[model samples]
Target chain A: MQPAVPLVARVVDLVKNYYLEEVVVRALRGITIDFAVGDFVALMGPSGSGKSTLLNLLGCLDRPSSGQYFLGDQDVSTMDDDELSDIRSRYIGFIFQSYNLLAQYTVVENIEVPLLYQGCRLDERTRERCLSLAEMVGLGDRLDHRPMQLSGGQQQRVAIARALVNDPHVILADEPTGNLDSRTSDEIMQLLTQLNRAGKTIIMVTHENDIAAWARRIVRMRDGHVESDVRNDRSTDRPAPAAHAAGLTASANSLWGGDPYRQPLGNDRP
Target chain B: MIPYLCLLLGFGLLWLVVPLAFSDKGRRSFVLALRSLWLHKLRSFLSVLGIIIGTGAVIILMGFGEGSMQDALEDIKRQGATNIMIRSVKASDESSTARQQRIAVYGLTWADYERMQTIPTVVRMVPMRILPLKVHHLERSVKGRVVATTADYAVVNKVQLAAGRFLSDEDDRYMANVAVLGAHVADRLFPFENALGKTVRLDKYFYLVVGVLADRMATSAVGGSSQTAEDFNDDVYIPMQTCRGRFGEKVVSRQSGSWNAEQVELSQVTLTITDMESVRPAGDVVKDLLERYHGTKADWAITIPLDRLEAAEREKERFVGLLFWIGFISLFVGGIGIMNIMLATVTERTREIGIRRALGAKRRDITMQFLIEAVVQTSLGGMVGLLVGMGVVFAGPWVSEHIFDMHRPAVLNVASIFYSVGVALLVGVAFGLYPAWRASRLDPIEALRHE
Candidate 1:
């Protein structure tokens, strides 16, 4: 088969720095990476290894000090803050380890934030889509719960639903399961893995070896440099059952239905 | 007690409504100020106490000043402006002093009267002679000042006839003993009945009352002169010719084995000028004539009615200035109070300002918001003060006249009210600007971090 997905993002020699009282701290030092559409990749690094810095560069949250970052063919490294925010809102979805949901908003309202920022009217159809997204995340009954009222796992799930609300091209998750217990982490990892198999590109940053294993490919960083970029050969073994991954596949079909591999197989759940 | 309570309740209502109506920022700052005040109720009440006392002081003091001015003006108006009065004084001369050791000698004779008539500005001069005598009507007997003058006396002095006719030139020429009664004299002599056509005894002579003169509006006096144009009310008027023929200028008063007697000439000549504008010139002409003819120092005095009226007017303006400054000080203090409170509010709402800026509010909008708050506080205070001031102005006379036994009329001056309110609003903006500018210049990041 042709390589299953085309290149969706490219970064070349991306460098970022911060100034604190005349001292320059280099957060990202000449990092380079390419991410294909529909690919699930995890960035792995120890503390101060620049994994989060690289993710921020990729998501357009911060600009490079002197380097090039491109989404598809657009060079975003030179864009101003407002322009970068616009590009981020339009093309990238973020899920933080802390599940940064606004405390004042309900679960459904939090999920609706990206749409509201997009100037999209909260009409019946848009509201119905929000409800469906909530249902898809298994939060259909807890749509009105505030962030303070929800458990850590449920809040993370709400953040995930919010990330998907804009139907962005790439999902950038930073330590997505770092704050969860093992069972909840497993559940979240399985959900992310199913999304990747259905052709939604996901780039995650994590220090955990087991969490990095959930991705089909991993990029390792040390001292602000990418040390290795390699595919995980073991991901092909004991893949999740078709029935267990049907919801993810269905959502992915709706998101990117033209792809042939996302079609229903004979053993798929009805 | 009930009316007093009602007044207090009305004042309370005014305190509530006036400030709100005049405040520029609508209900937002009002609500905020109210909330802040409620948060620290004792401090708020203490702050407002300053304003209350200040407003009350302005009202009461200004009210009394206004009352005094009105009384002074009324008293000035009562003295006719067109009448030029000339009075006689005792001349210090050795011969006259020795001849009148027991007599009064300062007076105008027929020669002085002829010289006064020669002045071109004099319209009409009425010569007056007085003799202190005991007059009786029926059972009523009272010591009175009797005057002998020409028919022109009534016209020159602006006296009105209440009944019957005044003495005519025919009466003076024929030496008729017909008299015109003064109002008080009529009241005293007739008591319950009309004094017209009644006979009154004056020093062994009987005179019939032809008319009663209207009550005098004001008392007349010259500066440092012992002579006053006596209230015509107590006088029994007769023609000068009749008085000279019937009761001579020499009169004798005997008491306690001592007798005093003297022959005096005309006591005064009251000249009427054609217009108020000519009163000054006419007075100068009469003074020059008296000086040239009398040839003696301290023999005569002249009074200018127009000059007195002008002096009264100047006094009124000074009184208004004093009152305005008193009111202005309180308004200034109130404005400072607003500024102090607004600066505190700006410090307290720093976080709110950051949120608004983050949400895209402009610097001008932030400036306007705080300025509006300051204006609201001061304007409200101004309006309350104004209403209270006016209330005192209107009710002052009523309370004074009825309860305090003072006959004062409260006058509400619109100019003062306008001036006070305008100054108040200006003070509001003047004091409010610095704090509002500080609020507008606040940095969003720092403001967001402020508690």
Candidate 2:
């Protein structure tokens, strides 16, 4: 009887340009895409391929020079900086590869930054929720450690915990595990994959093919244009190991009250 | 006392030394001015030094001036302007040191007294004659100046008789040898005893003491031959006719290696006016009359008590003005010092300003904070200056009397204190405003980014 809810994100004819002196450089040329709710999509591209630009646009850190971009039912291309910031705090969370955690804040305090920007008071309940987010990112034992005191992977985990603190509608990761070792990269990918399985929409930007393989869908771009958009069917049918699945299931239950590890393969809840 | 000093020092420290206390980015311009001032403390202090010295000088000088003026006024009140003084002088060219050969060039004669009585402005004229001699009373003999005057002398000069009665017209007509003892003369001649009604022998004549006169006050004028130390307390007053007949003006003068005698007319004449308004005009009229009677080379002097009173008042006003200006400078300097410190504080706290701006502080809020600080600094300085000024005023008399053997009147009044404090505050605010305004105009982002 009612029209089904539209996908979480949609872009049509998005064009981005940079002005130097009087000349305009086209960073992105008429890119169009759609992403369903709870879908985990990876964007792969070489340098200056517009992957970071798109992520910045979707995260509301920037606006396209020309085009329409809709996050759920709201048109983001027309929003002002203040409005974009508000939307970013309320609906979209970002995790940068460099782990941009404020050095002054401890792990828990970093996790509470989004809520603070959202004007949330640190009451007993909100503080407990921050602690729970820290636990979900495997930072429970390091809640009091400042970013400077933590190792690279640990700092990234704190950044991840901060990103998820506000419970936004979409998670945008720009090279989420690009700076980590192979072992830590797999661990971080597993964490991101587990988050996606629990109903969160994810858009990740990366240059590594191995990192892209972790996502269910991949979009390849070269020189400001999309080369291909493909579904990774082989990776989607294989589930994570049981012990790792159990741990991820526990973190999922803590994050969004769902057992993502026990879900049937190829479920694609969206 | 230490706590009060500590409080004062704390105020100085906050206003003068601290720089980080006033920063805010939203009020960057305001803060920048303050910072500039803070960076140059020495220059600021030097600039305000003139004001500091000026203020202190004004208060101290004015205070002393006012005190001296009050002293002069009190002296005038005691002298009674209704009375006039006439004295006899010798010719300036006279070279003879011999008393017998020296002539009384223009003495106050009996004819002058008679003529003065005819003037409409003259209420009463008392002729007085004096002769320096040794008087005896039993075994004790004292050298003193004896005077013979009419009964009205006591009334004309406002002299209070402590005992017995003054001479009457009958005593003058009969040439009675009745006398009044001055307070000092009485104490010296009859120590541990009363002199009233007692008989004393002057030269070869015996006189009975009728009364003892009260103490005479001191005068500040000097170098005038007019009655220098007229110790009314030491003088014995007799009837006019009795002094002329018994103790004649022809008296012996004894000096080192010289002995001479001379016969002179009246030594002094006192004129009284009926009203105070007529004193100046009457003095002028008498002077004209005396000039006509004597030649252009006349040797006589006239003193008008009223003119002296006016001079004293003028001196007081000038003194007060000078003191006020001096104090004003110091207060101004103090205000500038406060401004300098406040400016520095504004600069030091630029980041704080920015943060507060981001937290929603308005321009007015920053302005109020800096203004309040300036006001607080100046008010505190004013209060300290007041206390120090008061201490100096109060302690002046005590120190003078004890250590210096001098006495000075306390002149620090409530009005002066209030005025000084008010000026200090005004100076503080006026000088502090530019820095405060500069601080209040700072931009939040720029201020936060300030190194």
Candidate 3:
């Protein structure tokens, strides 16, 4: 039988070393990992567990000292800075802990930034797509609002819309709800859960167990190595099956072709 | 007309080239830069003020230089480039009211005039005896200079006739009491009727006005010329023989109830050369002849307008060079101001740089954004300065003339606008590069962590 989902990203024996004031510190020591298409992963670790370093390598922000990293069959570990930037723009989406939206740009302008780097003009087609993306993220009314004017959750929504603007292969979130209250964090998590269920791949880093419970798979790291990897079939914190379905279904099918991960198994949306 | 056309062409080329040179990405970056600059409107305006002052100073200084240089050249040109002038000056040791004679017998003699006429290179010579006197015509009087000259005076001095005729050689040979009134003199003495055929009195003599000279622009005193500024409009001309017979050599004036008497045979002799090339040598010969006759007293001076013109031409080059360096130093300091502000901006926007990098902006992209921002500021400043400078250049002379009662001309140099703008752009690029390069080389990981 063909594998249920093809691998989207693979890292083999990835090693990273950092020098702090003349002392060598091993941030990531020969770690191996694979992420399948449309997979939702929660990478959990305490401080100094090398989680941020691994995330940087996975997002193509940094290259490993000695290892192989493949994103959709392209060897990206040995790529130069410019080539890495190109790869990141095309295949990786980043969600920072602090919601790094350019303070000067309007919400719509922030979303249009990735397309700007791709040499796209602000023509009608791109403008319409940017509008639709903003609307899909529930920021339809705040298109011209700057980051400072919006609340924390709205700003994150703008960041998410920006991340999805280029239709990247995998979305990397670093402590996506680290700065929010529990209620706001739950709301942000539900938004992520809906995006993942709609055939998007997401890898989030967090130290909170409850935040990790929202993901279908959890990978825990300690001392620069994966300590445990588990599938969460009974994560009670998951949202209702039908919540946010109506608004997302139309954009999901039209934008991403009706869930490539579940279509091969002949499974229909619940 | 050609300068205006060239200015129009320069603007046309700039309008066409700027849009075509930028790609879509570059346009986007340019727009982003403009938005960022707009965010701090006051800071941007202040940062650009130095450039405005610098560029305006350059154009204003060059304009004044060109204007004054043209003024001096025009004065020299009217003196006739091929003409040399010899003027009689009183010897310093001889007093006008001498202890024994009460008459200062000095200056150029009639024999010197006879000697000069024999020179082969002397194409034409006009000798004149100028006496400061008052003229009266029917109850109205005006103080003026009476010029006793030969018939060649009108042609040699470029004095054209406005009415009737100038003095003829017969007028001098027969000692006719006929005179030519200068434009202003005619207007003042007659006022209600034509001065031609009318009689005007100079001291004890009455002369018939044969002609009136046309109005001409006055010539100011320039280098190497001993006379004060002359307005030819205030002079009256008469035949040399008539003046010698009627006025004699003694000129007496009463000042504060004291009698001042001076005897000068010839006040001035202007010699025109055959061509420009022979003017200097002929001047030397005239000086040598005068020296031989006068011995060591040194009572006469020679002025060659051609020599003064050449010296002025050389001085212009040095003046322009000095002006350019002053402009360059101001622009350099203005560029430093731009650099200082841009460096602060780059440091403040470090996290923004990281965000852009993560979103796939190349190093060149960051550099281009900051560089474009700096260039936009200076270009705006340059344009404002250009308009203001041109305005001041065109209106400066008129303002000074009215307010200060001084005629200071300012000629517009069209090329200065283009030069200032190009230099402003160059300054933007030069000073903005370090900050831009610093921004581009920022480590993305660390930048994201910055506050």
Candidate 4:
């Protein structure tokens, strides 16, 4: 229905099968999808729904067992491992749930990793770009800080800057705020919304309804297939910032240590 | 041979190094490896310890081996490669009647010395009469070999003079009782006073000391030849005529209830040929002449130092080869250590490999990174070992001379430096190949999932 928008990525009846201990798992069964430019799309599913597999395929982190995946008019489904890697480097940006920043590197250095793989010199222009990306993620003062030294929210911000440094065609975020307190999660969602408004395509995977509500379009997966596709009319109606302060204080206190999922949520109520 | 080897090594080093220095990705990988190594400084150092010890051992062992061989060769060289020595060894198969009568006459006689003078290649012949005698001075007495030879003996044997002059021909003609004191004898006989111008009694004959020889390293038995170990520092040199006049050919000693007399006119005849080419032929002539005259006695033992020198040279080649293999084996073991550490590093950094692969690093890039790390480690260890080995080589002689009171020369084979460093690089590449390949072949998704 969005014929006016240019398609950044399109998947046609894509299938991905995994062999685990002699059992062939149909992780993705003929899933068809299209992500348009500047679209904030959320892929939602329970565990074993193949939503993660679909995200992996869309990110070019894997090849489909069947069908074609077109990333900006190039069919990447049949590409080899090295070509897939190149596609990931040039066209796809991945934001992992664990904020997989290199432990040895500082903020600016981590953000410069993708460009380093692109064979770009760490010259004055490249350094300036990395510094600007760091500033964009609101970590201007922490440019020299390593991931271990930073709090969880700051580490995730570094990861976000790393994903944006290459100016990729699409940003694939898998559970962007899964480990954060609801307040920090909202803050991260706000950053994603701002990035989406600035003409960047974003595909995020989340199980929480509130996180999915932030996306303009929602694609739900079940049993290795897309169960439903819907558009949220009230996408602009964001949750109040201070509505969950009491629960936020409890989760924030233990965010540095202990299991994050066990912490109380700020907006469990309707 | 060494230059060609060095050239080949240079090309090989360039082959590995050019890409890393020129390519941005390669340079970044190098920096990353350096950072990773720096982070685990102690572990990296421990990992390379085997290489350090192995490389250092190669240089030091080869250096010492070369040095000692050179020293032995120098000793032979001092004896003159063109010289043939015929010493009188008592024949074991003397007649039973001669032994029962206590008169043994078996050795090179004065006639044999005179006959050897007929050899065409004989440039100079110094006949020596060696007498086992006891010398006494004041409260000191020492058993010493009294060498009665011409003044040519000093130059022929490279004897250094500490003080005074050697025995002149006039002293030999006049049969003067003037002698040259060996360093050991002089030190013992005249511990408090200068040996020159002093009198030391040898078997009841007081001989005036005309000279004192400086201490020199004694030549040991070489090439398992019949040449007996001679300590020149323990000898007392006297004139030939004076020795004959004082102690005649017939030396009668009164033992416990027995009288023994041994008749030996000349103890040794050292012949110097015109050049190295004539030494072997001259030696053959001497042997044949002695064999013809002595018949079944065969009392003379001919020792050509040139033969010993050649044998020693051949032995040195084999020794150096053996040392090379020892060094090779150690370096090989060191290489294995590097391989082991690299494999563990590949396993430990699986996640990093995944991250890099996700960022579009090619398999070759991963291989290059790990290979560079291995080479960097070995190269660093090799350089340090080289410096250490050279230090030991340079300092070894001085330490032995000062602390142990012994002379030990250490000649650094300059080629060993290049060999050690080159072999270190080879070891790195050889041993690092497997781990690097394994790392490059790792699946990115599987690696990312690793803890």
- TM-score, candidate 1, is 0.58
* lDDT: worst 10-residue window of model 4 chain B: B93-102
TM-score of each: 0.58, 0.54, 0.78, 0.79
Docking class of 3: acceptable
Better of 1 and 2 by lDDT: 1
Evaluate residue B334 in candidate 2 and report its C-alpha lDDT on the 0 to 100 scale: 70
Tell me which residue pairs clash in candidate 1: B19-B380
Tell me chain A's TM-score in each of the predictions. 0.90, 0.89, 0.91, 0.86
lDDT tens per residue, model 2, A41-128: 9999888999888887787766899999988767889986456655666677777776766554568866766665454555676677
Q: What is the DockQ of candidate 1?
A: 0.05
- For model 2, the stretches where C-alpha displacement exceeds 4 angstroms are A1-270, B1-65, B94-102, B118-122, B191-194, B214-227, B247-264, B274-276, B352-372, B391-406, B440-444
- lDDT of model 1 at residue B136? 89
Q: Of 3 and 4, which scores higher on TM-score?
A: 4
lDDT of 4 by residue, B249-367 (tens): 87777779888788888889899999998898888889999999999887889999989888888887788678778878888888888999999999999998988887767788789
RMSD of each: 12.4, 13.4, 7.2, 9.2
Candidate 2, position B346, lDDT? 82
Comparison by TM-score, 1 against 4, better one: 4
Each model's number of backbone clashes? 1, 36, 0, 0
